[model samples]
Target: MRIDAHHHVWQIARGDYGWRTPQLAPIYRDFGVEDLAPLLAAAGIGGTILVQAAPSEAETDFLLQVAAASETIRGVVGWTDFDAPDAAARIDELAEQPLLVGLRPMVQDLADDDWLLRPHLAAPLAAMARHGLVFDALVLPRHLPRLIRLCRRHPELAVVLDHCAKPPLKGGDLSSWRADIAELAQSPNVVCKISGLATEAAPGWTVADLRRAVDHVRDCYGAARLLWGSDWPVVNLAGDYALWFAAADALFADLADAERAAVFGGNAARVYLRRRGRGGSRR
Candidate 1:
């Protein structure tokens, strides 16, 4: 069962996506399941995890509603105010929805690099651990140390680092990002997603431009700890889904069949779906 573990669906008219400005004209409009289903079909993608684009709980509910209607969406990574005093209760409430598998705070957009290490987040994170909800760390390279500290504090929480911590692909420097990724990988509780890199690269990026970063992640996390994600409409900002998917395929082509299966789908099932089985026989 193949899963595109990270992607988003948003409606512009909803007025929740603060980041969706005119500058992002390529993907500034509404992107619903209707727009994505065909692409999934063409790629032979069996299932997907519909992730949060907006930080509003209303948007999370909207994503949950979409997941409920779309057979292709196997799980959802929703968002909420992690710093809210009632966050634990909120997470417990959201956990009632069986498809709600994870939560993500927009850490990358925050001004503070140590935001994840804030004391107030402990309770909410503990509640997430108790509810079996994964924490998708939407972070940048600079934020990785604090994330590592958070992982250490809550050893049981399942944390997946999104987008290889949004590495400096465009700037062409991996030294800091590489060291931080390696440090974070030391925590068995943390996993990394091989997604969103296409958008981080300069326009007209070749597969070679991405090879080193991909290889570095593979070395740090291994097949079992790494998962593949399309990042969908956001990926359209730098390259199309087909192009990114093909690039990922070529990059991991040297892996053994079982390792390939784990990176492509199995690890996502294990990490996000919390399922030991291979994700319901691929939709």
Candidate 2:
């Protein structure tokens, strides 16, 4: 099963994602499994991991409920107040929902630079670590210092760095970002996602533009610690679904079919350890 390791589900009424501008109005529509089936089907993508986008635990519960009803959604990366006084109990409750696979802090908007290592966040992060939950580090270039500090402090928490640490491909300043990413990839507890480059590139970016960052991640993380994600609607900001996927497909098409499958889906299965009869991806 070709699994999309990252995607988001949200409702306008639930809580507004202030980032959703009128420019992103197309995605503002409701996108449930019903809307996703065709996209997944067309791409031969079998299952996906539904990640959290809202700021509330209520959104996590809602995603879990949706995953429960759909075979296409094989896993979920939900959000939680890791600093909450009842964090352990809350995680225990989330674990009961079977498909709940991980957690994300929406790290991009966190107010304080040191928030990741603050005393309040420790208990929640530790709780997730105890439960063997992978935490997706959603960060931008500015947050790398703190992110690195947190990973160094909690070597046990498995983290998948979203968007190759969100490089600025369009700006063409790859020096510092690549260095930081290489440093981060050295950690055995972390993995990198070769996804979301389209959104960060020049509006007309093609296969070659993606090659730089893709090559960086492929070189740094290797096949084993790398996963693939669509970052769908967000990718739409730069190009359509087929257009975005075609870039990676082009870059890896020269490799053997097995290697191609590893980037598309196999890496995610190995990282998340999905159940039997679910994945058809090659390692």
The alpha-carbon deviation from the true structure for residue 256 of candidate 1, after best TM-score superposition, in angstroms, is: 0.8
Q: Which candidate comes out best when scored by lDDT?
A: 1
Residue 19 CA displacement from its true place in model 2, Å: 2.8
Summarize candidate 2's per-residue lDDT along 1-283 as a digit string, tens digits.
6778888776776665676756786677666778677888888998788888876888888988888888778788988887678987898777666677788888788787667768777777777787767788889887777788788888988888998878988876888888888888778888988777888898798888888888888888887777888887677678777887777778777777787788788888876654332343221
List model 1 lDDT by residue over 1-283, tens digit each. 8899999999999999998899999998989999998898888888899999998999999999998888889999999898888999999898888888899999999988788878999999999999889999999888988998999999999999999998989866789889989999999999999999999998999999999899999999999999999999999999899999999999999999999999998899888887323354332
Stretches > 4 Å off in candidate 2: 274-283
lDDT of 2: 0.79
Candidate 1's displacement at residue 106, Å, is 0.4
lDDT against the true structure, per candidate, is: 0.91, 0.79
Error of 2 at 101 (Å): 0.3
TM-score of 2: 0.92
